[model samples]
Target chain A: MRRYYVDYFLIFLGSFLIVYIVLPIAVILVLQIFDFSMLLKALQDERVLKALKNTLITSTATMLISLIFGVPLGYVLARKDFRGKSIIQGIVDVPIVIPHSVVGIMLLITFSSAIVDNYIGIIMAMLFVSASFTINSARDGFLAIDENLEHVARTLGASKLRTFFTISLPLALPSILSGAIMTFARAMSEVGSILIVAYYPKTAQILVMEYFENYGLRASRPIAVLLILISLTIFITMRWIVGRRRYA
Target chain B: MLKLKNVSKDWKEFKIENIELEVKKNEYFVILGPSGAGKTLLLETIAGIHIPDSGRIYMDGIDVTELPPERREIAYIPQNYALFPHMSVYDNIAYGLKIRKAGNIDETVRRLAEVLGIVHLLNRKPKTLSGGEQQRVAIARALAVQPKILLLDEPFSNLDVQIRSKLMEEIKRWRREFEFTAVHVTHNFEEAFCLADRIGIMLNGRIVQVGKPDNVFLKPKNEDIARFLGYENIFEGHADGSRVRIGGITLSSNVTTFGRIKVAIRPEDVIISKSDGEFEAKVESIESFGFASKVTLSINGLKLKALTTTSKIIEEKIREGDRVYVSLRGFNLL
Candidate 1:
């Protein structure tokens, strides 16, 4: 008797979910393609191309930096017990919950002092907010690995670092890759923080907002539409590469 | 040669207290006990993974207590084998030598893998291999290092019966062929019997007895040791200066105990016959093993275990309701 109610409830919830999440995206997608000239103007702009390049380079750099630092951090969190471990983990996840504007303000306070306003400031802001994704994912990946793998390597005469690089890293690759992708995506969409810390060299998200504010809806719509298309394209390509690796 | 002198380690809930052991060069030393005896802790201590709070670890007379694993030069294969899943079988075997910057590393790895019958599995990763194959690769990887001593903790417990027996035989053969010294720890007496040149019986983190497997089984140091060794014939009896008072009967024995004492006897020592003896017992039931049949008997409601040949059981025609005269030819008093 209860099973029937459960089935009906599940169907209701699933349909509601489909309508809730997919409806707005469907509307925007249809408007961007069907309304024609908006897509044309977005594609032709040199400023849009520059923003695209900036976003791609900064996000990619953010992801690379995250992987290099995050894998070890994840492994330590997953495998070891040390003082302040839980506190350190909580610290790693702090940026994700904070407001984007707040993150931007915090970066400005720290980086506006002349040492970090260059590439360092941009990269650090992106990493601060996005690296948590990689760290958390890598932690899960490392946790899934059987500890016996590292133990065996140690017994076989491989040093701790060698065992980590040769065994732990490969087995945890899927998770690390997922984390990197998440960080990349998060960094690419960053606008509020980049605006405060490094606004002169505009990212695509900032460009879209700038066009919308300066020149009314007509001039701004094309850039907004362009930003969305380019972001989606890069996101889809990353997913495809990771998906292939999974099968392999 | 491996030696652990006054070794003590505490692993949260379990503590191995003052464990002292020595495995001679080329000796197959097996540590046997029930659960929570800290057998695995002893193995790990020798492996240098767990440092003892108070002990001196010596390999071939050199003190290596404070040495890191690489400097200690001990190879340890845990129960799970800990195979590196990312590396191919060939790379896994080659890892140690590659790091140590040794010449002819390929030759060494290839030779060990071939000996372990894992040469054909060289290119495959550990996850692609079966349990038995992975176990062999783990062993091969350890053997490739050619450490002074090898520690194996429950290496056979993971395999199925069919594979376990075959692997046991292969492991024995490999040990003899390579002349490698090993310290194996397990709860199974059969593993201790078949593989060990010498056995150490551990109880509550202490090495209670260390000797040939037969000697330890035949002569347990105490009643608890006897029971731990699967000798389930322990009874509290009184030695009243003349003879000991057991279940409803007093046996004539020269062995003397001061007051209330525990009498331990191996089931194999008790003999059941239809002749006049000092005592009498009724046959409860008989269960058959491959070579031996265990006859359960009742002496004034006190249960006793006796092992006899299957032919003796048949010739005596022992049944649940049958009456038989029981006698003790001899016993090992602990």
Candidate 2:
């Protein structure tokens, strides 16, 4: 009887947070269902389409850049132990903890105006705030693999590079893919950093804010609903892909 | 042939120190040690996985201490087999050949798989295979490369008793067919006895004794080796000629030693009889082990263990707290 009470209490406490999270998204989607024609109109608007395109392109570029650099860093952090390794790991996690606006300001100061206020600057901002996800997930992925497999491959006449390509990299792909998806999602939702770095090539998130402030909630609701739908669709699809590949 | 002049490695908790060893061509050398004795470390050091701190390794009389494992042409199969989980059994067996870009890759893989009895498992992933099947795949994968020396670290330790014995017998046949030198490590006495051409008894990260199986089993080098070899009756005794005196009792031994020394008597050599024997002893305990029972006898403050068949115990009606006659057939001076 005591155990039953404890379980009920714990579940009640958890359900409050779950409702708190699901309520806002549920209300927005339900409200948009009544305004479905407005959503169709926003999807056809050139300005809205351009902002969505910019968001997709820049976020994708960010994801690719992060994959190119972050995966190797993750593998190194996972496999090697050297001086200042903890410091390196700490550095990888710094971007995640830093405020997104601070990330934009840091990127603005690091590069010249020629680089900022452009597509590159927007990508730089997104990558700064989101690369940590890829790095950490890839690190965890590599750590989950057995080192004995690499050792056996070496003894089987495979060079270290060959072993990495054939054994370690393939096994860690699912984790890496999930990390990339997280990076894409994080980049897409980024508005604070882009507002500071490059407001000209407006992302869908920045446009939502602009619409809300300039034209009130009625003008912004459709784009907000559209952004949520697209992000959820991509997120769920990517997760499904990763889940399928994981078991395969 | 592989040789280590003085290999050593130091880790935080364990160390393999100044290991001097050699394996002749096609010699099946087994390193027998208890867990944490650094058997795996020694094997890895020979495979060039971990470079020794301050010693040289020679392969066929050529210094290869600084060489990596890939260049050393050594194959290692760890206790878990370490089969590539992402690949099919066929691809695993063919991995080395593909790396070398050798000709007749399919033929080599098929031949090895056939010999190891894993031909039917060619298309299956390693995760789907049984332990025995996985072991066979690991063996086939390692053997496909035709390495100069095969280093197996407790290969059959994961299998059940029936499969373990079967694999042990098949491994002997595989070694003959493959004609490869091997350095196998295990803590099982039966494995060491059945498979080793020469046995090296490892204790505390050192090769304490190395000899033929019978000699090493019958004659251990020191007190520690004797204790590890299951000599339960060990005592410091004064020896004169072939007789040793231990605590108010003198026992006859085969080895001749002088003055103060340590002697070890295997429990199997301690004979217990009801009618006639050298000394009378009180049966302290009788523990049954299904087919055999270990009988502990106490005579004049000294304890000795004797192993006898369960049928004999039943026939003679030996039980705890009974008076029995005990005699030592032989003893080893340590």
Candidate 3:
């Protein structure tokens, strides 16, 4: 009886945060459904379409770049025990805790005008904020694998590179895929750094802010709904693919 | 043939120090050691998974100390079999052939699977196999490569008792069938006795003794090896010639040692008889281990352990306080 009461109380407490997260998204989706024609109009707008395309391409490019660099770093971090390992891992996680505007400033100082107001600037900003997800996720994925598998592969006449490709990489794929999904989602939702760094490439996020400032919430709300819908769709679809791959 | 010339590796907590060893071609050398004795590290060192801080490893008399595992023509199966969970059984068996770009991949895989009784499991993933099946698959994968040396690290430690013995028998048959040299490591003495062509007793990161299984089992080199070998009756005694004087008894040993010596008697060698024998002792305790009972006796204040069948306890009516005659059938001096 006491256990039942504790369970009920715990769930009631948990529902507060769950509802806090779900309420706004549910309200926005519901409001957009009532003004569904506005969402269609926003979708048809050339400016909106261009911004969406820019956001999609830049976010995907950021994810790919992160995958290219982060996976190797993650594998090394997970497998090796060299000097300054903890320091390197701490550095990998440093970007996550930094303020987004400071991240923009740091990139601005590091790369200067070479990346300013361009697709490279947007990607650099997004990568700065989102690469950690891929690295940490890949590290955790590689860590979860049995090192003995690689050892066995090596002993069975597989070179280190071959073992990595045939055993380690394939075994850690689900985790890497999920990490890629997070990287893409994080890159797509990034607005603060892009606001300071590359506002001209006008991602859907930037367009929403611009439309709101110029024409109030009524105009911006449709694009916001569209962004939410697209992000959710991509996120859910990627998650489903990862889940299926994992079990398969 | 494989040889380790004083190979040593210093791990964080465990280290194998100056591991000097050799395994002849087609020999099944079993390294018997307790856990944390660095047996796996030693095997890894031999397999080229780790480079020794000092000393050299030679394969077929060629220095392979600096060679990578892939170039060494060795196959290692860690405890739990370490099967490739993602690959099918057939693909796993074919992995080495694929790497070598060897011809007849399908024929080799199917032959190994058929021999190991995993032919029906060709397309099944490792996650779906039982422990014994997984072991057979691991062996099939390792043997499919036709490695010069096969290294197994406690391969049967994960299986049930019945399965373990059955696999041990199967492994022995497989060795004859494949004709490969193997260096197997395990903590179980029964496994060592059953599978070892030559047994090396390792203790505290060192190979303390190595010889034929019967010789090593009968004569452990030191107190630690004796203890690890399950000699329950070890005592410090003074010996002159063949007679060793313990608390109040003089036992005749085969070895002639000096004034101070350590004597060990396996519990099974200490015979407890109902009729008169050599020395008289009072039964102090009796502990039953299902099939056999360990009878602890006090012979003139010196405690000794003797093993007897449980049925003998009932037949002889050997109680805790009963008087019994004890005889030392065999003893070794260390």
Candidate 4:
């Protein structure tokens, strides 16, 4: 019976990590409620609106481009085996391992002067740092599906491409959607890459950084709190949708 | 007709070598082998799931060796049924039709679903259905396409014995109605006996023998096959014209041969007696097997087994360490 208390104490100690993160976000949210006018003013600011719009547009573009390229790569990684497959898989994970600032520098070197000041540059930088989530998640989703399902479709007079679209794609859609959401979130939160590549089409993260640098914590706190609030809301909603249909 | 000439494939641990097989139109061919005998690999190769390293596959006199699965018009029901978990039974059955944009999709799916007795399960996903229900759905999905050949990879293996036999009967009925050729693979001899027009026994990675069910079961072509088919006593012996000699015992054979050869006798064919027989042996062990008891007998440095009824065992007062007379009812020389 005394051992039970020890076990409970251990659990309580482990739960402090959750509290550590929740306490700061909770403090920020509660403080912003008292200074609600600052949040309203941040929302009304044309520069803030433009920055948020840019973030949304670029993240969505990154997600669509990730889907176009990542899904096929995911399927290949999941289904096929050839020489150097391990090397290919390792390369897919390189973005997650490397620093985001390095990714921005690498993209700049590869794309040269054309990529340094364009909206495409922002998307490319964000995609370089974030697309790993989509690719790995989609690969896992494809791996979860049985190879027999695809074979059965093939034996039933459906071509390979047809089987992929009709069976594998639909079955793995939930995981892919969840991955896209994460990729979008990661792209939205990206700051280092965007800061170097394209400063004109500033994302919300960069905007928050600019405000903090120009006018201390008071000016920047409202935008930071609003960004956190919106990100949390969208993240929770997407997760709920994923949980409801999590076949993959 | 479907034919495979020298079909071969090599995986890391399993390989099929020089496989030659033929199935006539509307024939039910069963490939019988023990576990790890490359049975599933051969089935997959026929289904085009695995491209053969070297072979030619023919269907209706057309060379389909280079054709992909879709172009070959074959339907494969894998061991686990492999029903799409995300799709409802209706959609699963309709998937092939939808892909091809075939005519009368709903009517065809409805008719096949009704035939397979899964009409009630059309709205349910595969995970929601019972094993038998899922099996029925898989069969419906495969049959909906009306392919040239249907490949069944141990379709009844995951079911209880009762369900297995029931599905076996259902498969026959469906085949008769649909008139489709099939290549069914299983390790169970009972399955081969129940559903096969012709059976092939596979060992290691080769089809050691192919014949009618009774022929293959009763007379395996070689010592390896005989051993695989549960022939208890197999001995290398000398065949001299009409008689074969094993150790000190000489037995008459209908096969006229000369020189060294292998002889096989099934356990059930060894007749055991208490009083009068040519050979005398001591009882080694007796094991009770429900309706029958398996008796092991040692004679002249040879071990042989016999299956006798439980009543006969009690009547004869047979037990371990008892002396018993034994005689060979028949034996095959290979």
Question: Highest lDDT: which candidate?
Answer: 3
Candidate 1 accuracy as lDDT: 0.83
Over B148-263, each residue of candidate 4 has an lDDT whose tens digit, in order, gives 88899888889998988898889889988899889999988889999999999998899889999999988788888998888888988999999999877888888799999988
Encode model 1's per-residue lDDT on A1-58: one tens digit a residue. 9999999999998899789887876777777777788667777778888877877888
**lDDT by residue (tens digit), candidate 3, B4-122:** 89888998797999988989999999999999999999999988889999999999999999999999999999997899989998889999999999999999998898888999999
lDDT of 3 by residue, A1-248 (tens): 89999999999999999999999999999998998888889988999999999999999999999999999999999999999999999999998899999988888889889888999999999999999999999999999999999999999999999999999999899999899999999999998889888998789999999999999998999999888989999999999999999999
Off by over 4 Å in 4: A1-6, A9-13, B275-278
Q: State the lDDT of candidate 1 residue by residue for B1-334, as single tens digits.
A: 7888998999977789888888999999999988788988888778777788997988889998987676777788888887776578898888878878889998998889888999999999787898899889988888888877888989888888899888889988998878889889999888998899999999999999999988887888898889887677888887777588777877666766667877787788888887665567888888998879899988888788888899988886777767788888666555
Q: Which candidate order results from sorting by TM-score in descending order?
A: 2, 3, 4, 1
Q: Lowest summed-lDDT stretch of 10 residues in model 2 chain B?
A: B5-14
Cand. 2 TM to true fold: 0.98
Name the TM-score of candidate 3: 0.98
How does chain B score by TM in each prediction? Answer: 0.89, 0.98, 0.98, 0.95
Worst 10 residues of 3 chain A by lDDT: A192-201
lDDT of 2 by residue, A1-248 (tens): 89999999999998998999889999999998998898889989999999999999999999999999999999999999899999999999998788888888888888869667799989988999999999999999999999999999999989999999999999999999999999999999998889998998888999999999998997899999989989999999999999998998
Question: Candidate 4, clashing residue pairs?
Answer: none
CAPRI classification of candidate 3: high
The worst-scoring run of ten residues by lDDT in candidate 2 chain A lies at: A108-117
Give the Å shift of residue B319 in candidate 3.
1.0
DockQ, all models: 0.60, 0.91, 0.92, 0.79
